[model samples]
Target: MVTNEQSVAGPAAEQQGFLHQVKSFGRPFWAANVMELIERWAYYGVRAVLSLYIVDAVANGGLEFTHVQKGSIYAAWAMVQSLLPLFTGGYADRYGYKGTVAFSILIKIVGYLLMATQHSYGGFFLGCMLLATGTAVFKPGVQGIIANANLGNKASVAWGIFYAMVNVGGFIGPWAAGYLRMMSWAHVFYANAALVALNFIILLMFKEPERPAFEGKRPSPVTEFVGILFSSVKNVFEPRLAAFLVLFSGYWLMFNQLFDLLPNFIDDWVDTSGTLAWLGKTLGNPTMLQNGLAGGQIQPEWMINIDAGAIVFLMVPIAALFSRMKPIHSIILGILVSTIGIVLSGSTMVGAYCMLGIFIFAIGEMMASPKKLEYLAAIAPKDKMGLYMGYANVPNAIGWGIGSSLGGHMYQTYADKTTLAKAYMADKLHMTPEAIAAIPKNQVMETLAAQLGQTPRQVTEMLFAMHHPEHIWLVFGAIGIASMVGLIAYNAVVTRLPKPATV
Candidate 1:
């Protein structure tokens, strides 16, 4: 039998465990997490397949746009979505979070509908812009709720759980999209719209946390928005923070390729027959064997889902482990690991290696991504956490915008299968440029095969031998390595600087 003192101590000890910290989070915190889950579900559903959809042959129900065009759209999308939060965070603080969230949901629904209906480049671009704007507005409000949730010492646990919720949505979105797109591409957009619409219901149920009150007379809404914009910009110039964000951008530049470019890379180059066979036999699911590709290959979205799945299952424990280290050290280590992952993933045509690389990258992402936000939150003035959180996205905007543009151009010139096939037809087959251009993009490989009296696989191998598309990954890997170096240097300089004296 336990002593009375021991019994009391056991119960007290249980109260300090991980489950207790999770259970202790307030209603507002949980509500914010739920909203984030739904929002990410909708956003990532589209993102999971966007690259393939953009460049797919028109005959195959894709837009048939060039890689460069897709990159431009992504560049603009990144800037609008990531940069606008710099102001929207301020707006969330001045206005109510509930109102901003509700407004953003409505805007996102409309954006999804537009994307579903409009097939033209201009029409689709407008839809993406609308979605970006809605996301930009949505982030700061939800993050602000998390910031002011009164988490105290449990902030790391809270943020880690919130990030896990994000990956839950991220995982589900692509997994669903892989099957949904098999039916119709439009279904993906329609489903995302419905998912976003669900957030409105969530907003109705949750209470917004109390916001910090403004001093003296309240300014007009327009005046407040402008003031926040200017003030947010001013804060970015803080030497240490500014240097940190700039260096961190290189990580995002490499990070975005996993989603934006890798899908197409896998589709065009990597052989997934081995993995697909294993998945089919193990799961015994008919759908696993039903992707439209010849040889029943795995869909690219399913491959990319590995990243999200890894995070959903593993992020919290990883966050807990890294929480003990300084945030900058964790970030630097993460970037280095992630760089290795990217290089490994891109350097191979073997599907198993690619999957392993993605898993490795996910590990690095777990270590780095959450710490960036937590570091900002820790250093922020309590009342200004929302604004600072908004600033947290600046590196994403800069890196993704530049990376998409450059990565797109690189893919088009260096690695695009169709472009390579066209060059082969002209150089070896003696086909005129006009004849090559006239072939439907979807059928170009088949046409080349027929002309050369070779199977499609043989021609693909020949092109691979002639033009090594794997080099594109090396470029992206270098960016990640560079960023890691920059962060390490920044941390050293900042650590050496004398601290301001206490009064």
Candidate 2:
């Protein structure tokens, strides 16, 4: 037994035994992942159509809100979704994860039903708030299960699997929503409500996993919740951290345009005949062809889903490759790559090219997104890791909120074909803004095309050329590029500073 061969065998067996122990995470962790997938599907299904639903003509079963109003709504939604998790994490701890998840799903179901039926601005906003609150609560509980489960060295791989599930939901949701929305936009919301309701069955079966023990007397749950919320806000406002968050907001501003602006942009300008034809040939479904396609065109959400599809297929490989790179470098490179991709997406009205651009953007997104948390983790004190990580969401909130506002303004001023047509009419036909506003959007398009002696698409092309709405893409691209440059400067300055000596 004391021989060298026997001693080596003992260590090898111990290593295998240790791995088995780590891999023995229970059913609850897997159950959480399933819930996450369904929840994402429901959330994104409505999201894919929200911007379009807001701005379309009232006759088309839409709200027809002004760009400013749309911007405000979008900003508020982003703010709530991004910031509430800091407090909700404490709430989830105080309340059990299983009950929290069930309550969130119930709220989501009600929210979706409200969104489906309500057409007023106030009602929609209320619906959005409910959905965001439910989402904020759901996020921590689902991730908490995975984090608390003793996955050991396999945690990284487990998280990767979780992300893949998210992308799968992301891809499927929009695609299905796009089809259902063609029948009625409200159908998309109702479908999401039904899906959330279905999760109740899973909630009934899910068992809570054991949580790590907290030491010492803690504040009352309400007080503890308030404390966590304040601490997160305070940490974000710390001088150097504040600067970083502000600078990083530029990238988020540009990044979020994919959801906030791109749908409208594509609907206005892009020709989807090529994509439709390909789908027709591939699927050979006449119903899809007849009902779904307009002038041989596909829905904007279908095109947008390409980004999710790319992530689903390519993220793991891209993540593995970038794992060796520095986090800052990965972020900068990702921004630059995404800038190029977004610019390309907006450069033309071609559907195939737009798909290609989104594909490229997905590559950069996968490369940079994970590195953000990694970068924060490396800089955090061991004891304060959770707090520092909570602070990380600040830039995202800033970016999405501010970016949506700016994107709405830009869309109104530059990229809205109807708005530009009105401007052109005022300049050419001596019409006032009020006179232009009196004309129906469809009538205006028809009149313009008749006067210009071109088809409607050709008129759009002429207006696009004369006014250069695509310049908005350059504006966003410049923002991303500026962020990259700022990050570089920030890194250089930080590196030159002296390190504190460790005891």
Candidate 3:
């Protein structure tokens, strides 16, 4: 029978009427949102700088990793960030959410501390793993506390607020890092350290319902993780949840690009430095000029501008608009609209096109992104909220890892690597790399070819002009359509699965 503890009236209950005792909001809700903001700030701040740090050359204080090496590390980081939660959530249940989150903050402190000093691959990767570990531990537990504390009618609004806070944190984290890194690269990591440190202190004042029976024991994350790995993996596939997870991966693949590839793309293609220079000249303060790189020529922090700016402009209004639709349809509509935007961002050689793409994509993302997890929460079994919510990251990880690998493959193939790069350049100028390479370093290939054996500059121009960038555009479009179609079919089946009676 439900005890007095379950039924007793509280402020949470006061908000609801006689028929419903569910919470609408409480002190715990505010505490949870505050903690979430700090966690996301720390996570995204560090993340925004990591890839750039890895790929930087000696001149730039970086390791100058091959694209493949960088991609592999990025993919691994994404995998760990997503997969680690499976065990960490259980460990938090057994230990205590507060303690677990505190421990996570400590881990992050150590991770960022190591990163600020260690500029090599070993040090960088160790830091990345630790960072992912901390993120994994904190995420589900934070949400878990929010869910448990606001168990009644307030849970929905409580979660919505939590998610909005997450985006707010995400928005601020990268922007702060970008601005700080422009001041000094060390400042980026220092800022992250400061944000995470705040979490450690803030959590001390936060209280939760109860720890599990094993709460006193400090569980080893590794051991606890391994023990539950199979169980959690098996849990999601038990007939009802499999289809959803499968389709959800596609959305993740799209969303992951924001974190994984967009910055780098901006680094190569954007003229932010030029724009900043122009602004500086116009303003008569050259020192005020900035690059697309936080510290250099490109200002990648502005890439976060798309996500932050877009969310601010689009999220609430879209949520209000979509208030009547099924979450699945919202996700579908979002995926389609965002995919078109993503393709437009990458397809055109122009930076303005990509910026517009991010803006449009942001609108789509605001519409769908929140509902993804909200839908999962609604459909999950009552007893397994921690397990399912923890698994919400599965899509994020899936998208990031796959997108990184895909971006690397594309970059290596077309932009930075051998065949596609050469072909793509050739498409621009009616010449192969061999032809370009054969010409003297300073000489224009077409102009020099006219000096050597080529018939005319116009022939090279004809050959180059015929190469189809449009085919490349189609490649991205197909991926988007394929994902949408898959989700449509998968959801067609998943909607029939057994869900909780109340949600």
Candidate 4:
């Protein structure tokens, strides 16, 4: 018999239970999430515009770097960012997380300030290194705090919340950056600096949570760093594990093309007037819309933000559906799906198709990214699972560094709209190459438009027809497909190998 007391107690107990689980996370988990969000915001804001800022002409307040230089800088930055955590994680463990986090913030502030002032390649690269170092110091500390706090049954939910917050910041960072960059590139840097400064203030209130005690006196940071570096080197050559990581690097190579090439691609190739027209018709002539569309096109950063946005909504459902699949199978499927998405996005100049491609790419990313870690954990000896998982960033570092360098050289050769325009002028228009080079890069489009008695958009279309810039897509598509195929071969070879002697 359901008495009044039992009925009232039933729902009340569940409510209390839920609150207890949340409270069990305590102060540190929430604080770490806040820090993660803000840091990602600053990082992505800088990244969203960095490639474009490097390559744009000096007359437009940009650095006017070559494609190779831009690609090298990006690749080097990614390598530093990924590798640092491996070296510095032990320092955070030995020293307190809170102090390490504060120091990292201070370093980042200096880095951003330096970036705002430096325009030369050497100075700018130094600034990027500083920023990467700061970020590397910060990531492990905050992640360590969150991981320690989410022990036991609450781990799954806590990680979910943490990832959601990350995506929130990621989406906003690029969305805001695309607008700020329009005012001036310096403004974007300054804004990111200010956000990092704000996080420093938040860091003041963070209380360090409990972590496992070290068994002995903590080694000096330099010693610890060297030891980790040696271990990383050793891991790369470790039998079947080495082969697995090498294959995994292929996916990241293709995935990174989104950031390394797509912004410049959109700026040069896509006609976003259709998107602008739709917005104008729906919202009417608002100042914000008009200012943002001054070039009669949407900013590339805004287009890229779609990937983050899609991940936020789609990841959970996609992960749930793929939960039953084998790890290797999911990874292979993911690469194929992502490759198709990349081809679709790049093969067209249409705004809608570009967005649709990113959406599909995000779905593929959801399918594979988590499983990469899962696969690593599965093959490890039970006692060494944590150590094996730590090496997961290896593929990202390798892939980004190699892929960006290669992609940049390829872009310079095949797809750079400016270079192709010059070729068209010398070949088809009967103009001297010297005269073409004399024109400012930014003015090339307008000058061509005037020469042909057409709009810049029409000239862009004409160039597409004559030069076949779409061929660049073929190159990128081949890279993605090749990576997918490489993974399949890796799986077959590794499965047949004798299981390694356990560490």
For 1-503, candidate 2 gives per-residue lDDT tens digits of 00000000011223345456435656776777788889888888788878888887776777788676788888998898888887888777766788788888988888888888888989988888899889888888887777776666556556655666677777788888888888987898998999878777886665676776667887787788778767776676655566667777788888888877888889888988767766776799775565435567778887778788887777668866876788778888998888898889888888889888877887777766666666666666688778767766677788889988888888898889888888888898787888778887657788778877888889888888998888999999999999989988887776665632110
Q: How do the predictions measure up, each by TM-score?
A: 0.90, 0.90, 0.76, 0.91
Candidates ranked by lDDT, best first? 1, 4, 2, 3
Q: Native-vs-model 3 lDDT? A: 0.65
Task: State each candidate's clash count.
Answer: 0, 0, 18, 0
Assess the local accuracy of residue 379 in candidate 1 as a C-alpha lDDT between 0 and 100.
58
Q: TM-score of predicted model 4? A: 0.91
Best by TM-score: 4
What do the candidate models score in CA lDDT, each in turn? 0.82, 0.77, 0.65, 0.78
Query: Candidate 4 at 488: error in angstroms?
Result: 1.6
**Global lDDT of model 2:** 0.77
Question: TM-score: which is higher, 1 or 3?
Answer: 1
Please identify model 4 stretches exceeding 4 Å from their true place.
1-20, 282-295, 497-503
TM-score for candidate 1, residues paired by index:
0.90
TM-score of 2: 0.90
Query: Which stretches in model 3 have alpha-carbon errors above 4 Å?
Result: 1-31, 148-152, 206-209, 212-227, 272-298, 377-386, 417-476, 493-503
